[model samples]
Target: MGSGVGMGMGWMWLFWVLLILGVVLLAVVAVRAFGGGVTRSDRGDGRMSQERSRARQVLDERYARGEITTEEYRERLSALGEDR
Candidate 1:
């Protein structure tokens, strides 16, 4: 009787642990679904700024490497709508 009682209590503890884990998992899913799961790249202007900064860096590197002439560099920068 004592052994059987201990076994039952062990299973009961396992059941409660599993139940709590399942609830937490459900809450995370719900939050991601209904809490506006917007990522960094989806923030519009911020992402555009990051892209423009990257473009400017690449352009500067190319110019530094003498891959393009000053005229071409100025044209590309103007096309990108950036003065500097």
Candidate 2:
């Protein structure tokens, strides 16, 4: 009887652990599905646009300083798709 009770308790513990893990996994999926995480770029705050402008300014400054050749500048600007 003692051994049986101990075995039942062990299984109960395992069941609870698995249930908790499943709940946690479900919560994580729900959060991701609801877009509750930060994105790599564009946080919907206009900050991404500001960062792009800053990058362009830096690129222009580099070109003005003769740090980068015109070809390289044009190539980089085209890569940035700002040429259009």
Give me the candidate number with maximum lDDT.
1
Residues 1-84, candidate 2: write the lDDT tens digits: 455656667578889999999999999988988976667565677787787888889999999999999999999888777994
> How well does candidate 1 match the true structure in TM-score terms?
0.46
lDDT of 1 at 28: 93
After aligning candidate 1 to the native by TM-score, how far in Å is the CA of 39 from where it should be? 18
Pairs clashing within candidate 2: none
- CA RMSD (A), model 2: 7.6
Whole-model lDDT values for every prediction:
0.88, 0.85
Model 2: lDDT of residue 9: 72
By summed lDDT, which 10 consecutive residues of candidate 2 come out lowest? 1-10
Model 1: weakest 10-residue lDDT segment is 1-10
